[model samples]
Target chain A: MADLALGKESSDFKKGLQAGISIGIGYFPIALTFGLLAKTSGLSIYETVLMSLIVFAGASQYISLSLIAYGTGIFEIILTTFIVNIRHFLMSTSLNEKCEEDQLISKLIYSFGITDETFSVVATKEGTASTGFLFGVISVSYTSWVVFSGVGHLIGANLPQTLQDSMAVALYAMFIGLLVPSMKNNVKVIVLAVFGAIFNSIFTIGHIMAQGWSIVTATLLSAILIESAEVIKAKYRGAGHEK
Target chain B: MRSEIVWMIVGMGLVTYIPRMLPFVLFKGKELPPFIQGVLKNVPYATLGALIFPAIIFIQKDDIWYGILGAAAAFIAAFLGANVIVVVLGSIAVLALYSYLL
Candidate 1:
């Protein structure tokens, strides 16, 4: 019985690896750009690669690079990173339901691998995602993210000065790219983004706060304002139905 | 300077790990309140928006179009439902060409 179970586990692991291929491939350019950006932003190759190795969250890492460039304080950067990654809470909770019951250690091990892409893949799988399978999926995606990051840094070092200067815009382009699709799908997202941008501009231009604090404040305020509006709208709709 | 970067990365790693791990370890089968969930859901979009603006225009101080045009390319690609990689690559391609022409 043990032998049979081991065989099944191996097969499940293989399946997970196969499933992760697309995510791994998708990560190539993004991770590479992140590495390049880190270098351009004045991070040492060691620091750049270490950030990828440790943090492993894409948007937060990118944001950190920006904050670092602005000479933001360490504590502020960390707080901003927390705010950016707060959505992971929801993803992790939802994934917990989809994943199989396992030892706490096992759950802990695999949870580290959960990202937006990995969560979607695992949560959407037809059956409960086994621990081995989660490992399989994360292994591929993690390897690509870490490896390509280093590669990008190396490439950045070799690029001409002019191209390097222009590459600075790619980070913002990446953010716009990520936001546009969700904005198209949900009007609320558009409102949230616009509000966030407007508030951030006001704060930044007025010099009311440091750059890091400005972003953190803008994000929290916009989220709260937009979601409260949504809730109020929903309540009014309910009232209208009752009337 | 090096130590500061290390501490920052460590701090980031902690904050990041907490969110991804706490729910798995602590919550057996519970859901957050609807309002909290709604706020959390909007956080990413809000954060993204905040990150882009103000900063985008300042990317190339000498030539604002450098930033605007790159953002336009990314917006178009993303609007067409391209994946993250394509959107990034598309913007890069556009900016590379723009720079080359200049």
Candidate 2:
């Protein structure tokens, strides 16, 4: 009986890993670009890979390259990355309901591996998600991110100087890669991007604060403005319907 | 290793880790306020926007047009729901071409 259960668990893990294969592939270029950009930003290869190993958040890790380029302070970089990742709080909260009952330690380990992609894949499974499956999914994804990040950094560091400098453009390309998919789906995303950029530029030109802080401040203000507008619009429609 | 960089890496790790793990650990059987959920949902758009908008236009100081072209390629590729790696390589391909042509 125990042997049967173990076989079932192993199969579940293999299935979860199969599900994550696409996500792992998706992470490759993003993580690679992050590594390249980090090298361009003067990070040691160790520093570049270590960031991925530890932080393991894509956009935030990529954003840190720009922050480093800007000569932003360490504290500001951490703070900015934190704000960028704030959405994970919501993702995790929703995922809690879907996660199967397990030891607190199991939850702790796999939760650390959660990224937006893993969350979506695991959360959308047909029924309650097993802790073993969660580990299988995120472990593959996590390994891809960290390992390819190192691969990118090593490849980047070996490139000639001119090519290395040009790779800096990859950072903005990375950001656009992130932004466009969402904007295509939600018009509100377009507004947020348009205004957020305008606001951050104003702050940059005005010299109101450091660049890292400017991004953080502009993002918060834009999100708040748009979110409030949306809520108010929904309220207005509801009231109008009542009339 | 510089002390500051070490601190920064560890700090960023904590920031990302906490948000991911906190809810699973702390909210075993609870729900959060609707307002907070609403805000969190928008965080990605707001944050990605703030990172990209004005900045993408200026990523390359010498030839701004290359940056613009790169953005266009990435935007289109992602808009079509191409895999994220493909979206990135698509932009890189464009940027590389612009460099060669110009």
Residue A126 lDDT (model 1) = 61
Error of 1 at A185 (Å): 5.5
Off by over 4 Å in 2: A1-52, A55-107, A110-156, A160-185, A238-243, B1-16, B23-30
Give per-model TM-scores.
0.63, 0.62
Classify candidate 1 by CAPRI docking class.
medium
- Could you tell me how far off, in angstroms, the CA of residue A91 lies in candidate 1 after the best superposition? 8.2
Per-residue accuracy of model 2 over A132-219 as CA lDDT, tens digit each: 7888889889998999888988887445434544455554555565566666666887887777788888988789976656766776
Which residue segments of model 1 deviate by more than 4 Å? A1-51, A55-107, A110-141, A148-156, A162-171, A210-212, A238-243, B1-16, B23-30
Per-model RMSD to reference: 6.3, 6.2
Query: What C-alpha lDDT values do all the predictions have?
Result: 0.80, 0.74
